[model samples]
Target: MRNSPLHGLRVVEIGTMLAAPFATHILSQLGAEVIKVEPPAGDPTRSLVRGGPSGTFIAYSHGKKSACIDLSTPGGRAALHKLLAQSHALVHNLAPKAARKLGVGREECAALNPELVYCHIRGYAAGPQQDDLASNPVAEAATGVMEGNRINGRPSRLGPSYHDQFAGAYAVIGMLAALLQAKTGAADRHVEVGLYETGLHVAARDLVGVQLKTQLLGRAEREPHGEFAMPGYGAYLTADERWLYLLMLTDGHWLKFCQALDLPQAADPGLARLKDRKKAREQVEELVGRAIGALPFDAAVARLKAAGVGCTEVLPLERVLEAPQAQSPGKLREVAFRGLQFQVPEFPRHPDADDAPATLPPAALGQHTREVLEQAGLSAAECAALLDSGAVRAVDPAGFAWAPVRATS
Candidate 1:
């Protein structure tokens, strides 16, 4: 957008995997120019078995320029230093020591640019396990997120990458706070976000639920029944075997539900109130299930809603893609890469740029290395030497040109 909040900001993202890259991609979506520095192997995500671009990679890597630089080499480190010197921010998710070893640690980066907003993401907090590599399920498991998500009495991890994305979003919030400080003429600052901590934060509600069940409900000896324990707050199967979720948490909703079903048992004094209904949970659930199961899916959903109970048919992933809500403007953005077109959710939105957000394709590996180096004032021969020495890699840049004048470093 012409007046995007992050316009003219420059970020150097020395990130691997999902978290850090996703944070930087958020910045890019908000109109920052994010230069994603990858190792020679190209972030390891490029090798996924996907038919085209890896979904995980594309989701987090979109709208950023990629520069392949082998940080193990002196030339590569020097180039990164130059970029950081000109960048407004630097973000990475490398292990603590690995970041320091590459000379991109918080202190090193601050020394390069005193006003830079630096963000570091790691697997855990600053403890003995701080330096261990962390990915999605690892942090999810370590933080007891999996344990809290019980399915049929067995602990299960979420299939989606929750910890990684949560950490990334947390890092983005930190970056934005630091950027605000810098804009006010503050010195460079560092923000650290850990996947383990994010996992804990994400599962905080469940943790609270567990405590309430044990302490308040006095169910310490019994594993508290889940949402389905509430008569009106559960799923029901229709005649066609499709499921619909019903949420009747309040007395008003419960009364409406009972009135809609016209259940003679609901009029009983013992079952009129929610507290009493809890005592007859099985009977209520059975009644609700039978009432719902006698109808088709649509009829079941309509009945529940007509009764003032919030309800929706459980949608599979494929059905969700076809839903009208998914087709709403600004919900998804169309983007193209290498002549292939697809849609991704438009996110990291701004109040001002709601209608004019950029939908640029992700950069090809090393697609902007030469362009960035040239903008950094490197001679063509110097750029050639770096590429030839295997210190850096780049595409021809064919028609791409980027400016280095608004250096963030």
Candidate 2:
């Protein structure tokens, strides 16, 4: 019953994929009344994978309502405009050309509601390469992330959905700033965020470093890209095939690590010194790897921890879900829906000690269609008519899948 940070704010979401929806998802978690406007076939993310809800969709769309509308239709567009007129903000990720065709572009929406903050998410900003197609991997490749991730001759992409998540965070920050500006009586503002731009921003340090050296940081670069810069900060495979990632940056921790591994000569040989260890990176890695390989995973981790070195077992997805850290007090919560238990991360606490409400499981497609329409002032008859006219549809308990229209020759 307590007021949340975003209490009383209303957001209209017209995004199908990750970035824009993710921004609105934060607003929703902070108590905004977010109404997600899905196409007749629904957001592509809803059907991106088989079985259960699209994990990405479920994660981003928790605590929001949904409505299926065929925006290309005149009646649907009118309904969307009405929704926009009542909303405080609009967030979308439609392609530039598609947004123009649907009449939901920033200029058009601002014309309808001068106070509405409109946020647009794109694959790239306006420039010579503005029109280029950029999915997450493509953006990563373009921004040098994928290339920099290669080490020891093994080139690999970053872990799941990094670009989408990063861009989403940036878009949310922009929208939040616009909201503050609106409260200050500033006119409605249009904000744009691009995945490629966010990716480049994330790699700013590496890019700048390479520029300074007059050489591009390519996949062929042998230098480590991440915390690997620290001589003792990296992953080591244990005798039991499990990995133990440890960080021993300070001199005290390095000494403790050598003592923990019972390698007295490790310190005497000057491997404990930062500069010397970095200079002999390969030799240090080999010695550490050999020591780790000699011990069972759990025992090695216990030894390192007992010696005051910060170390943890590298957890896989399933293990992460059941991690002790995740189950600790005030960490994660489990919500049940339709005989399924869903675990979601709790919101970050506000400095003033206020917190958002407990999360609701993601809606089952347009699960609250009738309720949402009624709340929006549509009569029951009108709601039925809209459904019958193919302008809207309710979530089917049986579920549905996306089938994008294909061009025929």
Candidate maximizing TM-score: 2
- Model 1 scores a TM of 0.88
Q: List model 1 lDDT by residue over 1-409, tens digit each.
A: 6676788888988887788888887788788889989897777665563323477777778888888888999999988888888888888888888888989888888888887888888888787888788778887788766765788878877888868888989998988888787778877588999898888798787667678778987874333544545676878898999998888787677777777767676567787788888888888889888887888987766766777778887888767757787786666778776566777777834434453446668788899998887776778999899999999997644422322246578
* Alpha-carbon shift of residue 297 in model 1 (angstroms): 1.4
Clashes of 2: 0
Off by over 4 Å in 1: 50-52, 150-154, 208-229, 265-269, 348-355, 396-409
Provide the lDDT at 90 for model 2: 89
Give the Cα lDDT of each candidate: 0.79, 0.79
Q: State the number of backbone clashes in model 1.
A: 7
**Candidate 2 local Cα displacement, residue 60, angstroms:** 2.0
Query: TM-scores across all candidates?
Result: 0.88, 0.88
